[model samples]
Target: MNIAEFKKNLLQDKISSAQEWFFIISVSLLCMIVFISSDVFLPFLPEMTKYFNTSMSLSQMSLTAFIVGLSLGQIPHGLLSDRFGRKSILNLMIPMFLLATLGCIFSKNIEFFIICRFFQAISASACIVIGRSLFSDVFEPLKAQRAFAVLVPLVSLSPALAPSIGGALSIYFSWRSSFVFVFIFGLIISLFVFIFLPETKPIEKRTKNLSLLSILNNFYIMLTDLKLLYYIFIVCFSTAVWWVYAAGAPLMFHKMDYSAAIIGLLYLPAVIPYFTTSLIARSLLKTKSVNYILNIGINGMMISCLLLFLLESFNALNVWTLMISVTLVTGSNGFLLSTAMSAGILHFSKNSGLVSGLLGTLQLLAGAFSAALIGLFANVFDKHYYVNLTILFIVCGSILSYVLKRKVIKHEAIKSF
Candidate 1:
């Protein structure tokens, strides 16, 4: 009935008639600041390459390195969230991110820029992964799924709008100024979260020593679980497809004669489906089975990829066709990411924070590896490379779906046993 009652119900895992949508919004806002800096950066890669006088592969190092930092921080941040708390992690990340962006703005050398990107990744990624873990901690299972459904769209808003923002800003100012906007966004979110966001983790559940052996033990348990592994594979696979687009799309745009601004605008539309479907996925959470939703989404991705291959086979090279395929993949992610995350922590409620950390680490680590590999086939100003890039990403997503499907069967078998 009141705030205290609502909090109690949420923690006790009851989905009553409470609207904690604002909590999801706050976390999404925090994540937007993080995603904006990283996701939007690639749209300007062509321009940045020219500015920094770096090769395409070399320029890519900055992105991959940032991702590596994101992967590396997942466990520690999750452990810290368990102990020091989510609000603390949120507050700590803000200043660190702001400083990292400022570093990007002022850095005169590629090495320095790459280092700053890495630092930024370490600070910024905490907001999303730990925040997701907190959501799992607070809400009932169905409610958590619905909450992420609302969030997927809002979170999708960042990737959709960020490039358009970056492209417009880069055209008017130097690429460095884009980092300044990231700085400002981080500063604003930090203030709001610090001032208003409530602490989710209790002192009792917190762990002080996040030693390697403990981490390994946690991971070992997770890997051995068939359900969690199945869901995580979807997260990894769907992300690979997204990265495929991320790697190839800009070059494709340049071939289409779109400037950075135009390329970003084109990129923006694909994320719309993601935003829309996230909201839909949340609503569907109460009604549909996780497997049902996942099957539909994975199929959509597979179909989207197959179509892309068809277009390639037909020599049908255009931005619109590419956009259609991208939209399907992004939209499907709306369902896939939410389901995977919800399922991931559900099986390990005792170690929700640690579970969040491991899942977060794998998701980012898998995405980074996929993206780095996908990047190999895509080059700046080379349209031909997109074919291979697309094929590779589609295959990755397909393999993920196939493996995850097998894991799903294993999960059911364990239950039957």
Candidate 2:
């Protein structure tokens, strides 16, 4: 079929089962690519520090820059995709990602590398925003929740796997090899999108008013909605917990004189619990309410943080203890993130692109803040301090989540009355 006919076919109310699976897999991969960009270079941070003659904090700036880009870039991507179309914006983004990856691979200094990573994240952020919006475009509320559960575990694999891949590449070649891998991955995904991915947002569905004022007003409205803010913060807190662990764990391991490869292998154990709880969360959805599942998750996180504090206090905290505690935190998040995100998006289904973008931007902004926080306190504090600080953040988040859950329930009850 010609381009117009092909596009029209994709915009149908119902696609074939095969097409559905293809779309799901493609979007999952897109999400994975963004996460890989975030985490693949983690194992190389120490090496980057030595090579660039910079401090660990400076090297960590690459991560902060990328996350900041991931955060800020989502707004524009979401706005444009809502105005233009998903596939077209994705097509534009993948090329930019490829170019940024090249810059990362060829950078002569840390400053230049940091800039490249930022651009790389900016481009890759489209995947996250549009990938989420596509689900809302295609599925009803209930199906979208299940789809998100599936998507979470798949995307979670990247953070678990990317460090291992980067460690192995650093062992065999150089740190730049990780960027090469990312570049190749981006190229393949670009081609796949060009050939297979469809335009989910048709002309009739797109936002007509593309003015700055309209966009700003939309942002204002969403920002003022306490329900949406609560859901977003739930995801954000979970995200921050993961990033704190991610940012601190590597440094802790490196200080212990562990090899990069072993440090990479250390992340593997968390994946088991993460995947298990995600599946369990999916199953729980069949019989339980979203609030019920969220309660379990929030409680799990608090209990995990308490355990970490107890372990650290008794001087029993080691790599194994730390990892086990973090595994639980990650597991709890698997239950929390997808459920909260889907609920929020479905609640505001008319503005799925904007919601998706706002959610991602805030989530990664939380992550970026956690990473920067870790970097700021890394040298001044001992390992125990990191653990303590992490616990504090999780506890605060859990408490806020509880308060917000109450508010949401009260607000909904009043509306029902």
Candidate 3:
């Protein structure tokens, strides 16, 4: 088919061929693999400390370095892709990721390992920001939301699943095996992308000038949109809540005498609800408005946060209770983030790459900051402080939700008029 016809079918949701679906699924896999990267080696973190003979604090910097690099890398990659084209950026990044993974596998010390992970994260981040932009390139706004609804829940499964794989690999082979597995996975994916993935950003549509000022101007314009900013903050805060949970949960489970394998299993209850909610999100789009879905998601998060507060206050620290509370949080996160992302990116259709990069950067930075804060307070604060942070985030998110609702209503009214 010709280019116009192909785009028409995509916008119309006529993904008829197996290859088309594979393309979509492959890109989604690109998005999902990063999260797997995020957590696939988490189960081996303590082992890594011992293996490298590093302090606990230094060992944990592996995660921090990756987050920081991922956060920092998005904007530049997005801007460059917008200027230079997407396919080339993808080709460059995937190979970088392959190399970085190998570096991690062979690093002699924690410092080198952390540096390798940072580069690995930088390379993997291109897939995420570019993947979001790719949806806008191929699908119309509504179709893109539906696609996100379906893909995100599946993507959300990575955190829980990766750790299980990591725990198993660490148990059987070694910590290095986890990196090897990822390297092999990255190699295969990269080969597929290089061979099959076509450039979505057409030459005529690309920015003519590759200037820092032009990039900054694009960001300035998008950041000034109050409605867009609100959705961005919603994504940011929601991500922060999840980050805190990830940071604190391992310690909490350890205190409760759970091994990494068992902890991985415990995450399933929470993840199952999250996946179910994502499927629900896809269906909800047919009958419900975006604002309605977003509002409901916010309420869900608030309710989940309150339950966590109550449980922590009462010292109800059992597995079942903790599972239920976290399930609510994860489910609500799945609900809110997917919708917020769709709405936020729709506002910047003229520059999807830039906005996707900004949205991703903000969310990752929020999570990074939360992780840093948790690390800082690890010694000073009690374990229950994690729950307190969750409550605080919900309070902040609730206020942002209120503002977002008001702004969205006003924007809609203005558009209607």
Candidate 4:
């Protein structure tokens, strides 16, 4: 080939590879946004409580408010993306997120700050709902499972990192500094998304009837699917366990006289197991069934619960024991979340946006409910009670997974006959 033709071919190859990487990274970042938004400022909750002269339980309302917004906001974004396309909805939401972050920074009262957080989470919800839909839109079932395996670990980093960042910011500046950091981060990501993220949902495939009745009908159909319902419940329970730990742990540590920074550093240990098991799940996907991986996760969680119970019964439920229990549960989650979500989305691939929204709604609502339960009952429950609550959620999740597995086996047996 001539030098000019060779140069053109090289340019084309570079563009193709760059575009692929950009898409993967962008989706992973998108998935992380809500998580970072939710947990980044948790280390500062005590600071926020004293600053606003609010009780700790009321201060925690801020987290609950954001989570509520995250859950409720997803449905409309999914519906609109189905009708207008993902890029347009995301563009609109990113600006709203930036604006809400500014509101959070400028708030003079606790109530106003809580309101701003609600809107912040509302806008941030677009990232996760649309991000997951993008994968479903592009990849088939098995490939999507592998993609989520990669994406989940990357996404899990937010919860690990956010607290440390928030702690440093709180120690040196103020809780408001965390909001400023989030604002800058959102602006940079928004620019990249605007420039590089392609519209995966095409006009030809767009849902035509986006009326209220139609939306409700779609929800009814999806909710009635036994398989999808099982997947959703499994996700809900697993997520609730994490949120309980996230919401309760800092307060417990603060009571133990640990500084915000120390509490933040404490979160780092759990992430290692979570990240490692996620990688293991990805490797196992090649030989093992999704159900097999899920069974392993369920058993891991059950073991964690038993350990927690033993620790509590022996009067040994301290920070170290709590950390070990949490690490095990989070590690197990590495196997559960991606496999369940990919399977759920693949089952309803044609309505990926709506299903994504439904899944996101239920998932975050579970978190919100768990967090709120801790906050509301903080006065009534001791630190060890939080561990008990975590154990309860794990047991519930294991039972659900077992039931689903049995149903699958029975269905297969009948088919074989």
Candidate 5:
């Protein structure tokens, strides 16, 4: 082809129509694949313990390693996309992810598996954050909310579906087979990203001085964005709830006599709310104002807490109460998630990648902290653990309320912008 024709082809490869349902679905699947890769190993943890002759605690690190990798790797990936361009950085992550998947399959022991799991987490950046940057680059304000509506369910489904998928694969096959399943997912998703996914960051969008100082400055700008802090609170706590749930579920399910097969089903009830909320969140963004959604989501979380306390008070918090509480907590946040993310990064339109990265990183950091606290309280004898957790959620909700009312400023952060 002539140079002119080739240029047209490149642009075609670099852009997608924002309105298409297929594009939205494609974005959702890409988002799901990363989360799926990150979490699909959990169900297999017990089995791997037996096969590897290791403790459950040791096998747990495989999960921890993935979080560590994802948390640390996102910033650099975002920064690189900002400097070089989103499309190429996104493309590069796909292969890295595939290779990491292969590492899981080839690992001979727990040692190698944990190492590869960390690498997989590190490489899986191709899916979630990078995909987010692409959507952030291409979509407009209200339409962007629509895109996130499509995106959140699939992203949320990762955790919701992971245990079932991991559990089933482990039961029928070997735990190793589950890792193999993730590898295939990585391969398939990598192909989709290569062919259909276009680069949203055009040449003109790229900037000079992708230096440490610039990245540091970008980080500072995000931290100080007063409007963004509430958004951060929204994403982080939404994430924190999941982290808390995941941290506590094994024992909670055990207490309920939830077998592996049944526990897989347990995740379903929670996921329904998450997916439902995505649609609700998208609609609210269009029909309502940001302040309105923020107000409702915070209060809704408080309402959920009271419901949780009621359930605990009666000691009737069986599977049904647990499921409903989890759903309300996740679903209500859906309305807030879109508003928070869209508003959070609006000020940094010029530094989309770095801003997205910082937000992603901060949210994950919040999740990691919450997960640790949950793990600490999840003692087998402590029946009040769930009640205590309900209180924690209330605390998070209260802080969010303050953030909204006070218009909390990032004093040190302001000068960077």
Candidate 6:
């Protein structure tokens, strides 16, 4: 090959086409449904207790079941997709999602409803793992980072909007209406994906052996790679911090005597920073290295956490301070999530399916654990728990940042030598 051909091959995603952009958007939209499934239930929690004739705690098991199913389903879906091909697996799962949505809508009892949500989350898991793997199949590291920078912010918006949509549906119609809304969404997405999205994983590249043991062994091997481990840690800590904030922020607002509606509006400011920082990240990737941007983001998060701690300790915590601190945390997340995912998946390109599955599984598991841990302490610590949780988040993030700097980043430099 000539020099030009070699350079072209070296830089993956050199050829940008309309079809590629459309495929990325379609996958992003598919992945967004996973968040929607979780968040839409948030507003329905109070009604759910009454609807199910159960205690609040028991009713909340629905969420936990969904989380478990979502986390556990990714590995199998990803493994199957790698063996069977992306299009067939995606087509199979989207319809299952639609069926699960319908089941949730009409269920007469809480147990059945929870079961349906579990299946719904399992089906949604396909979107996340396969969508990410598909990105790796088509784009190189830098281009994949750019694509995620755009995609992550859009997907993140589902949580911000879900409560509003859920609340409206519950007020105007019924709690059941929330599931109906999701069902209609599933129908539209299934049709769109079936008709338009092409199979990206071609026959030549499909894994010949489809065995559970092989998938698990590859998963374990990937976990042992130091660079991949750090990348996963970056995503885990970033997701944990967000879940901590999501769990504790409401209690802090309530202590300030803010009404539910007013408190809901506060999420808007926190969410705006995600979009702004994503735009900033996209622009910086044009000239800066991914490690540099990731370092800046992690440092920004640590500082934000420290500021939040001080503000709460001084009894100076208010909406503006809260907004600023939350913005820093969420904005940094926007950068970290996309960059970590791109860099991490690149490290395991040969096993993109396994890597994507492990990434999604650990990400959800970490977020769930974080949220649960914060919730356990919320009553005892009262409003101060938010400040303390932020500190914990920072402590965890700082360790990951050290690993990224000391190991992953330095290893790359040594490679150049």
TM-score for each predicted model, relative to the true structure = 0.82, 0.87, 0.89, 0.85, 0.87, 0.90
Name the regions of candidate 5 deviating beyond 4 angstroms.
Answer: 1-19, 50-55, 312-316, 380-383, 408-417
Off by over 4 Å in 3: 1-14, 17-21, 46-56, 108-112, 309-317, 379-384
Give a tens-digit lDDT track for model 2, residues 218-266. Answer: 9899887888988898889988888787778778788878886687777
Clashing pairs in model 2, backbone N/Cα/C closer than 3 A: none
lDDT of 6 by residue, 1-417 (tens): 243442243234554465456656777888888888777867888887897898888788888888888988998887888888887998999989989989988888889988998999999999888888877777766777787787777787888888898988877787888888888877777865676555767788888777768766786788767788888888888888888777777877887888999989888888888778876897888899877888878888988978888897799877788788888888888778878887787777766787888888898888888878877876764456777777877887787579666986677788888
Instruction: State the lDDT of candidate 4 residue by residue for 1-417, as single tens digits.
Output: 243433343323323444545556778987788888888888788888898888999888998798779878887888888888888899999999999999988988899988999999999998888888887776656666777887877886887788777877876888888888898889888966786565667788899998889888888988877778777877787788878877787777887788866877787777788788888998898899888898898889989989988998999977887888889988998888877887787788878878888888888778778988988987755567788788778877788778876886777688789
Q: What does the lDDT come to for candidate 2?
A: 0.83
Name model 6 segments beyond 4 Å from true.
1-21, 409-417
Q: Candidate 3, TM-score vs. the true structure?
A: 0.89
Task: Quantify all predictions' global Cα lDDT against the true fold.
Answer: 0.73, 0.83, 0.80, 0.81, 0.72, 0.80
User: What TM-score, to 2 decimals, does candidate 1 have?
Assistant: 0.82
- List the candidate 4 regions with Cα displacement exceeding 4 Å: 1-21, 41-64, 106-115, 171-176, 251-260, 312-318, 380-383, 411-417
The superposed Cα distance between candidate 4 and the true structure at residue 105, in angstroms, equals: 3.6
Prediction RMSDs, each to the true structure? 4.0, 3.3, 3.1, 4.4, 4.1, 4.7
Please list the residue runs of candidate 1 whose C-alpha ends up more than 4 Å from where it truly belongs after superposition.
1-19, 39-65, 102-115, 171-176, 256-259, 309-317, 379-403
Clashes of 6: 0
- Pitting candidate 2 against candidate 3, the one with the higher lDDT is 2
Could you arrange the candidates by lDDT from highest to lowest?
Answer: 2, 4, 3, 6, 1, 5
